[model samples]
Target: MKSKLKMKDEILEYTHKEIENIKESFCKEYEHKIQAVIEEKDKEIHAMQKKFKDLNEENTENKNEIAKLGKMLEDANKKIKKRDMEMYILLDENKKQKEKAAKKMNKVNELLNNLQKEYTDNIP
Candidate 1:
């Protein structure tokens, strides 16, 4: 009876030790899996960060290009205004020349009328 009790005690002790070892191994495997998941998430986060940085850079470049185009547009508008002023000056000069030609035509007509009257008086 004493031998039977001692054998039973030893078996119980061995069973407890095996259960503790299994629990420890399970905890280690769980920690390893959690670490792997965390690393994968970190990689994804870094990739996303890099993509965001590149987009921000591209946006900055686009903004700069837009500013340059705006300056160019402003310069073009100024040139057009200058050309408009030149065209208006030419129109004013044309009007003045036309008036001068009209006055010369009136003087020539008056001289011709006087000449015709004198010739008629002398003939009579």
Candidate 2:
């Protein structure tokens, strides 16, 4: 009876040790899996941060381009105004020239009429 009780105690002790070892190993594996998951999440977060930075840079470049285009548009408008002023000056000068030509034509017509009257009187 004593030997049988000793054998039973030894078996129970061995089983308890094995259970403790399995628990420890499972806990270590679980910790390792959690660490892997955490590392993967960190990598994803880093990638997202890099993408955000790139997008911000692109946005800044676009803003700069828009500003440059705006400046160019303003310059073009100024040039157009200058061209319009030049065109108006040319038109004004042309109008003055036409007026002068009409005055000269009127004087020539008057001189021709006087010449015609003198010739007609002399013939009779």
Candidate 3:
């Protein structure tokens, strides 16, 4: 009976050692998996940041182009207004010259009528 007890004791000791070794190995594997997941998340975050920066640059360029077009439209409108003013001045000048010409024509007609009356009286 003493021999059987000694064999059973040795078996129990061996089982305990095996259980401790399995626990250590499982902990190491769990830590390695957690580190791998962290690395993958870091890479995804970096990619997202780069994409956001590129979109900001594109938005700025579009705003600058719109401003340039607005300035060009303003300049074109100014030119149109200046041309309209010049046309009005030219039309006013033409109207004044027509009035002067009409006055000169009336004077010439009166002189011819007076000459005809004098010649007819001298002949009688």
Error of 1 at 30 (Å): 1.9
Deviation from native of the Cα of residue 57 in model 2, angstroms: 1.2
Greater TM-score among 2 and 3 belongs to 2
lDDT of 3 by residue, 1-124 (tens): 8988998988888888888989988988998998899889888888988888998898899889889999988998898888888988988988888888777777777777778778787895
Better of 1 and 2 by TM-score: 1
User: CA shift at 19, candidate 1, in angstroms?
Assistant: 3.2
TM-score of each: 0.76, 0.75, 0.56
lDDT for each residue of candidate 1 in 1-124, tens digit (9 for 90 to 100): 9999999998998999999999999999999999999999999999999999999999999999999999999999999999999999999999999999989988988888899889887895
Error of 2 at 58 (Å): 1.3
Once fitted onto the true fold, the runs of candidate 2 whose alpha carbons sit more than 4 angstroms away are 1-20
Q: RMSD, each candidate, Å? A: 2.7, 2.9, 4.7
Candidate 3 Cα misplacement greater than 4 A, ranges? 1-20, 94-124
C-alpha lDDT of candidate 2 relative to the true structure: 0.96
The 10 consecutive residues of candidate 1 with the worst lDDT sum are: 115-124
Evaluation by lDDT, superior candidate among 1 and 2: 2
Top candidate when judged by TM-score against the true structure: 1
lDDT value, residue 70 of candidate 1: 100
